[model samples]
Target: MIVESATGRRTPAFDTARLRTAAERSASGVTLPAVLPATALTVSSVTLTLANRAFECALPAYACSPASLPAAMPDTGWAPEGRHGLFVRNHDLYLRARDGNETVRLTSDGAEHFAYGALSGMSLMAVPLMRSQSPRPPFGITWSPDGGQFMSTRFDERKVESFPFVEAVPQDGSWRPKLWQPRIALVGDAERGDVEAAIFDVAKRSKTVIALKDGWRLYGQVFHWSADGRSAYGLVTMAALKAIGLAEIDLATGAVRIVVQEATPKWGRFNAFIYSQPNVRILEASREVLWFSERDGWGQVYFYDLGTGKLKRKLTAGQRTVRDIIGVDEKRRHLFFTAGGTDADPDPYFIRLYSTSLDGGAARLLSPETGVHLASRVPIGNAAPGSATTAALSPDGNWIVESHSALDRPPVAVLRSARDGRVVAVLETADVSRVAASGWRAPTRVKVLSADGKTPLWGTVYFPPNMRQGQKYPVIDAVYGGPQVTNAPADYREAVVTMNPRSRASLAELGFIVVMIDGRGTPGRSKAFNNESYEVFAELELADHVAGIRQLAERFGSFDLDRVGVYGHSFGGYTSARAILAYPDFYKLAVSSAGPHNFQGFYPVEGLFPAADYGDGKNIRPNPAAVPPNYARLDLMPLAPRLKGKLILVYGEMDENALPSVTLQMADALIKANKSFDLMYLPNQTHDFFRTSAYYTQRMWDYFIEHLMREEPPADFWLEIAAPSQTTGY
Candidate 1:
């Protein structure tokens, strides 16, 4: 099994003099005459760096004229021709030219909260709560193909309620608490955030607002532009998120037209957290559209007439679920996509690539490997017109590049013919010999029956590197029982398992057995599997985890069932806390971080759960005054009295996603029950408190070592966070 290992090379720390010397020795024949005295080197009207100690040639045309503009946003609002950079400051849009230091104000009517080209939405939930300066929001604008004009969304959140937050321990070293009130919409609030689309012409310096349906707002931008450049397209969804429509807007008239609309009995999803996208592709040349849906129990592709918005045919079928659209060769009428649940593979979660005709035909396999094949269609020139996470296909659409891996295997990149699933060449195989030599071992793949005793569950088992054969170790269940994603990594990646501080691998290093199971409700399977926990948040696949653990104890002699502990964050945090309360005899201890123990306080707008209980009127049931019975069943506060195992609650004081109140409420309940538990609040941190993760991880190690292992930890053992290294450098 191939495994990836670090290149083990440090970036050369070059000072200004070294940089200047390197630039002088460049192959471009650059010398002291051309090299500027400043750190930056402008060669051939482009910014070049001598950091690599090499003068690279044949760069992209855009690279020849990099923007030297002082910008507010990172990686957004750049002209299609790379001639200008766009940014929002003081709620107004400004353009900075690439060739010269010419800056122009694009809009003037923007006010404090009524802003143009502002990035504000459910996406930045933690912006208001954090103690740090509010980051400059991106100008949520889309550039025209010709780089003459751009379209942007206006953010109007002035009417939304200002949620109060206090920096108890001010970062600025203030004596008193600093109060901050940011416009944040809560459940049952009458006024929430709103958005509208508008076009800004560069030459004329004029703006035209698009006539959209009331209550409809654009999130990002009009992602697609027509071939004629006269129109653009974007997704439109209501507050309920139960339906989604592809709308086309005329550039000149600013008139909107619905290209196609799809709704589900359950709420439709535009994006599921960060794991997936809408998975919609518009074929403008052919006047056709390809969309993904789980209507047939599995995610399948369908064809529709773009102009008529009528279903033409179902392009894909069966139990296999289409994960992503890789590429489309319009001239040849070929479509490539990634999918899981092939009948031949024992593991249903293994993703594979398939190619078929856009006119509808049997899908031809493109990656026949017996593992997860991650096919990518990277953006090259004008070939693949999708984002990095959206789609990837070769320029010619003749070859498919995929990295294949399994639980115990590393990655092996292969190039296959797009016409057929033939492995034309083996590009690279990860070398883990160095890691192996250092006594590192691959995780063991484990499978067992779920709580139902019929469905199969997959997971991985991590053992201590120096484990003795005769002695059993204490088991720790590294769980994130959220339905949105699976915790178990399908391949070998440090972030997923091997070297992540919070991963099971790291836990196993402390002389404990670590296991991660993807229970019934997690995604990457059939719709039936994902819907298992639809309205029932309390269940959270804990029973399935219990069953998996019980089965593991019966099969292997290495796991100690009596000393099992559970740990997770966010939704996983709720599950980890719930594990001890529900299955006290199974999970002896639990560490929960940023768990929204009560559903009444916070609810995601993803539409996976009922939104009406919180005040949304467009859902299945709308009851704003009283806690809905469905939400009542999800509250862990009432279950606090049932806790018999050791529990510790962790939270970031400034977290907005899980709310500080949820953790405090759980603590209050435990106290009312006269229960003894540990509580910790991270100062000045938000939902993703990655900076102080090492300290928390060390505390977790101490807690597990003391409670589960029944041993004393070293006195104040400081687990210092590793300094920035080339291995994980930005």
Candidate 2:
């Protein structure tokens, strides 16, 4: 069968002969799986309907520092009229004001992917240009509270040099062009982006910097706004090399006071960025706030007093890691946060969300339900909570969106009252109706005791879509077991391609049982379970998931453990490799995509390498204690020959996150060990090549057609799907 998207892209299930030929061709000089094979397996792609774009907070949500709970929204991007809205355009700061007329445009220097903000109405912004990779200031634009006053970052980039990338058609069969130049600064050195914002007073129509400082090492202008609009707060970390200074700035006087500082520690340097992603700003505030600090043994949270620049209280005073501050209902006085592991040795593997009173109290365990993977936070209305609640809490704070799955589910998006965590209204259901329409089997959630005997693990079982209950089926354990990331209980669910269920889903669709377990290292369990894999990334968590697989298979007797398979990406890749190499009898087929195989390559930025890698952090959170060398160094290749299971490896050649080198480095060893396996290398793509629906569908289907069910899909099925074409290029 074949499928086509509305844009006319193709996904055709071709003959098995073609698959084998492609596989052999890829084997010539390429190190990884360069070609599809002409075996009985058929592989194709599927477009996914992923809700990646979101305004996130629907209610009165705070934009707190990632480490702490946010109390207020920065004046830069709020829609004044209503409390919530989204930035519809790029490079432009927009806020819904009280008036219903036109939306306010705070900055014109905005470009695609760039952002907008405000220190206050009176203070202007100094922005950096688009595609800028400099250690210079990035002051785009700013606005005041009432939304009347605005200021812009002052800069004259006329003197800076530029590196141009003239787009051209590919003549040969490659994405790399015949002509190329790297490191062309968008803003040149003569005075690399040295410009101050021209202030514009809404009342007087004035233009000037609040306090003029020409070329200081300040580059980032994070969020800042006074609740009353009388004052403004600003945070700037130099964009220059050795970037390690964060402070609370006075928008009026241009005076800088260090709220947090980083210095080289005993053995390493405190050389890392303060927040997670580029635009995640650390806000200033009080109450239910969480702060990230290295002061403790691990990265713990502390209540902060933005007014006094002091640590008012240590919320999570332990050795584990506090991942994100999800939400805080001040009126209710409860804090919502997610963590990976326990107080002793935090594992980066598992994660869970927890709730506690804002006035310092014991945390209420909410997620992980006991597995390595997780259950995400889903809350509904709470205009006010009186007495009764369902699911667990009222819609405002409590709700079990959905449980993690192995084959049948992606992630479930349900509306539940926070008062009792009961289901209210469901915002979205990933093709549930379609699953029923397609005769897909629904899985069940189960609990398995952990190997440690101290904790319990949770897992989801996907049965064959239309198979008899008493019949036995081969089981495939599809999982991703690492820290820093998670496989949601509810995510996208249209088959891997339009025709497959990820490894688990496809197998379930094929009359085989599919299991996905959230072992201790997986997220959404509890602070302790999520962090169990912190220092080490394997076995500790894998043992738990594997145990669940054994228990579940045994209980059902409908499971053919002798034909078990394991598959995953990145950390899951590491798991798959280990399953066949270490626990050969447990898994018969193993497939991995961009596994770390080595941790050295997972090094922090070069700047933070010394301090973070073999090093340290000044104001850094509790360190992982160690960062692995490149994934290749793990050398699963040596054990490949000793494996009793078949193996498949796939990776993107240009993956910045999981470099292709990780896979290539392991190939030499695998070949020397005379290991037999399949490989797929995507050119001109990056790590986690699932950005586009097409990319995701193709990668997913190809692997399954060959290994899981041992059948071939279509070659031109992609061209026939006719899925919705995603918008790109203005």
Candidate 3:
């Protein structure tokens, strides 16, 4: 029998017809009963929900199959607002009225090479060095509070380099591949052009361009239009993002003034995880501004007098880090924010809501519970308590909509009094009866020391069902050692497999323990702790992982130190392969999918590659000689010969994030080094294996089962399900 798998891969199932034919023949030439086949076997269908979607799977009476699921969809395209909004069409910006009666084209020069909004159509398969000529639009446009005028950045990349990738199409019953080249601008490329801030007068139908001084560039989308629509504020950094400065732009004359600028020796590069985005807010009535900085070694909010261009005071000061600003009550001189690492909380990663005054007074913790608190302020002057609301601010600024949860407790939405931090009314409580009935156990949170022996590292462990005393189990280290994302869950019900529990839990069912660790260089801690990977990405990052595993094994008796496997996607994928290669004797198995193994050969952008401050303090430029060595240390190609365990590599042919070539390069290097490994390439799939994730999942399961368990998977084991009918809503 043939069955369609979740990734649409057809697999062979048990041949029921042959079984029935064999039952008809008897050894004594006597006719066997038709019920003989049914005596010991029962065929049924089970509808299982994987990744929040339902799939019908066929299984025998006593066995269950793991359902393979697809990856989450990417958030792209335009998001509209109210009656009028701006969007990109055919690479140009267009403003459309909700009634469909009026439409205006804001940009006409937009083209494939030079488009408005972020650049598109470039395949990640191409080499990044050759794609530097590709012109990209501003991160996005900032609309004024009144929506009359908007501020955007125009990226000029006509002088940048170009690269090409082949687009394959099937025509006339034959495969045809066409070459397409796109121009991209690289961070350190000398030919990369400049970006200018442009303000479009919607009513006046005119545009004003604000020019920056020489040797300066706009950092991401740091500019924002004022509420009164008279000026714009943006952060300007040197080309390499070493020295950062905040500036106020004059709308009338296109003049610019530096409000605040700081140069730090530790300004290695612009990493979203390690550093907060430039959050600048303007108060229309007071002409004051709130800006985020880490100058004092911790993320804090600072108030500045815009008129005088001088600092008023730091609104928040503590060992804790300010996460984000929720809402500002200018009338009451109050500001609400989210922070982590509170001194009173046992879990430093648990984020809480806090309220502070504009005059630099003490900050009051609004939700002081020992859990992750997500708070939203209700619209001022419309606060109605005891209503079934997701999030709302009180009219008097006394209450807020708070959703609280911990590692053990499910989420509960409640209306809490801001003054006393008391839950006034419970709006919603999560029902965990279904979870309990399913026999699913929450992973136990574990704490371990970093390689430094002083800093703390957090992780979670999932044990196999029906554990026996003194029995060791093979451990699978599900790693995502990306500096940008933290893998360990902080809130209640925030499991690593929350979206796809069966995907990870199935590994545990297969008789292996699973673990996720957020080691050093990961975000959500203090700035200094996260800077461990600054210029040293590979060694320091991997040291933490190795130390965490060893520490956990020493503490937990059930962890089998001899048998270990590691796996992850993208950045995690890079780490997985590096783990086995770097520590061949420890990690016995690895499955790395879509990893940028050859980091230096691809992109030299700010986040992709690290830069150092030479202390010249005048103009910081990328030193080509300094980057190659760092890349050499992290590149897996040189270490391919160190592979001493079972390893499988996977890549999507159409991957636009980490190009397929990056993975293929490692394969080529492994061949040259004569190293044994496995490789899989899925066609027509992008960075996320939305259509082929199930195929790879099964492959990974088989690899670990055969290599680590020393047992063979079923001859025709098939995990079948249907493709997602629609894109994921999230």
Candidate 4:
């Protein structure tokens, strides 16, 4: 049943009439939405570096020239391209002139190739020692500190592995079988081989090999350099079955040294916090190596001295994951960052700007731990109140880049004085301008007691556009449950749901509620809270989720638990699959997309273990043989059949991460057990279907609506499940 506030009353909730009009409105006026969670998970599309304005975004052109970027762009890599712009254009390298008008073509063949950072930008334009007649596509590129040199990886084909998957036909296209095999995702023999890292000297306009030792050499990946660019450091493993080594290459002296080996995880007493986002999200942090490592039991800030070729010093300690490396005030020997510790009452949304010595010492939380997440460094010059938290330090340590926002406030970018942390020039104002026309609904902050009331968990509910105070509606709980990730929306501009355009419409048009929460086990809280279910990953995570649902069920009378369905992808998928089986009565239906039916299947060849971080290379590990006598375990696949609700199991045929093979294993078990489940399979898609955001989204939304909204089995359900949908794009 749908509920609304009193007519003609001043209310923050969206009325039915207004919502209907919104759904009826065309999709254009809507803000052009984000297509996918950034593939550059480890880093963002744009980075704010020491150059102050030397922000880098992926370029699209092969012929990138310095004259292509905006004049206001900051200088980075020491040497500025003509216009000081860094970008990836058309999978190639192109430099936006300083004037930001004309673009210089850097490389000729990037059409089918993909290169990530700036070194690739300058390399495209940098004169090559020898350009192959049949040019190879660029893979990865890194520029030297001075910008005159760059390191690039050309992964030559002829020796790699590739896999293919199925696809679905679009509603507008005639049904036909289509094949999709995304490169780098599932490489075939034709695309096989290894990578080569070559340094290109822009000043000399020449290419030189730093190191070429290998069978299947993997260079160019972990790119790090000595402060002066006379030497470079990286971790490389041989092409052998299992390779491991940290090598230091002397550029000027042409010497090589092995500093470390077997860098990947092995049996050890180490701490690990895994997240889907690739790079460390901590920003505005720097000083002596400017990085963090989890090698120790804690994820701490570490300053490595390349000149000495050793860990310079342990920066920050304790259980906190040095969440964000804010900025390093080198002159003051201070590194600014954000993290959650035992110091806060609730989760420390307002991460304190911690200042510590580069050589490791006592750390202090700078922010009061009040606000939610923050934007990158604020601009320098302006002095807005509370602007200190958003301030970013300049290259010379004289100015700062300023930015700010709150859960309900949109971010504004302006310059602020570093000394006083005051705002200067305003670059952007509140941008909710688009969603504002149609009243915006802030997520209701609610606290629900855990099954063990001692641990208080929190969640947010975004009542549809215009929701009433005490309303009952169908809610879509978008679950993440992964310890390192949070599904809760933190800032105003960054919405809980990123746009796929095609699917969002159907989601709201079909009339359903959406919800996301970060229950216990999620990162950023005190270490103990984050460790509640240590050895067991999903059990407590989902329990907290179910508890939140029950609390909402009681607090908001209209929410129909009978119609509730759980869903997620990867870990999210793992969570949803478990939700249905673990709390059979709490969830009525489930839609697990690209889920793993069993952990053993995806476990590395080393085999399954209790936790990735468990074990001491010498012996003390959670080996199964020494299993505790009484352990409450969650067996999803075997237990799925016991669920008394509609179930849809989706998989991408070519998934490499949560290999489809294991999911298929579960499908077989479900069939033999005679349990009812809906299956939707994608073709040529990897476990990270993150690249194909559009279709996966539409199908997911439609699947939810078809099952949850319509609440009925489809007549063609078996037919759709019989074969792959034909129109999928890679």
Best by lDDT: 1
Ranking by lDDT: 1, 3, 4, 2
Going through the candidates in order, what is the number of backbone clashes in each?
3, 174, 12, 94
Whole-model lDDT, candidate 3?
0.66
Candidate 2 lDDT over 1-730, as tens digits, reads 3322222233445443443343234334332223331222223321111122111111112111112222233332442323433242444544443334446544466543223331211121111112223322224544454454444553343443333222233334566553322222211122333445444444443344545232234443324454454444343333322333344545444455655444423111121113342211233344112444444445455665555656566666444556555555555766655565452323233455566675777777665333332333232222111111222333354343333323345554444344444444444445556546665554566667777876766666777766677777777777777654444233233223321124465556656677766676554334345446644556676677677777887787788777788777766776777777778777888777777665443323332222222323222323333332322234465566677777777776544445455677666667778777777766544454543335554656555555656677667666223335321110
Cα lDDT of candidate 1 equals 0.71
2 or 3, greater by TM-score = 3
| Candidate 4 lDDT over residue span 1-730, tens digit each | 1112112122222233433233224222342222311112111132212221222232221111111223333322223233234455554455444443665555554433233332221121211212113333233555654465666665433233333334454222658754443332221112333444666555454556666454324433434545565666554544321344445666654346665443433221112334211111111133124444545544565655434446666778865655655454556665666555433335444344456666666876544424443436442332211112234555555444435555566766555444444444555576666555545555565667776666766666655555467666665666766665556655554452332111222344446665566777666555456655444666787877777777788877757676777777776777888888877777776777777666533332121123322224222224442312211253366675677777777787556556676678777878888888878777645555633645666567667767677655344432122123332212
Query: The CA-based lDDT of model 4 is what?
Result: 0.50
Off by over 4 Å in 3: 1-108, 117-139, 167-174, 178-180, 184-189, 193-196, 267-279, 342-344, 376-396, 433-438, 496-502, 607-609, 612-627, 690-692, 720-730
Estimated TM-score for each candidate: 0.86, 0.54, 0.78, 0.62
Give a tens-digit lDDT track for model 1, residues 587-693.
Answer: 99999988888776563444657664534443223455455555788888888888888999999877877778779989999999999999988987787763346
Residue 232, model 1, lDDT: 78
Q: What is the C-alpha RMSD of each candidate to the true structure, in Å?
A: 5.9, 16.6, 14.3, 13.3
RMSD to the native, candidate 3? 14.3
TM-score pick, better of 3 and 4: 3
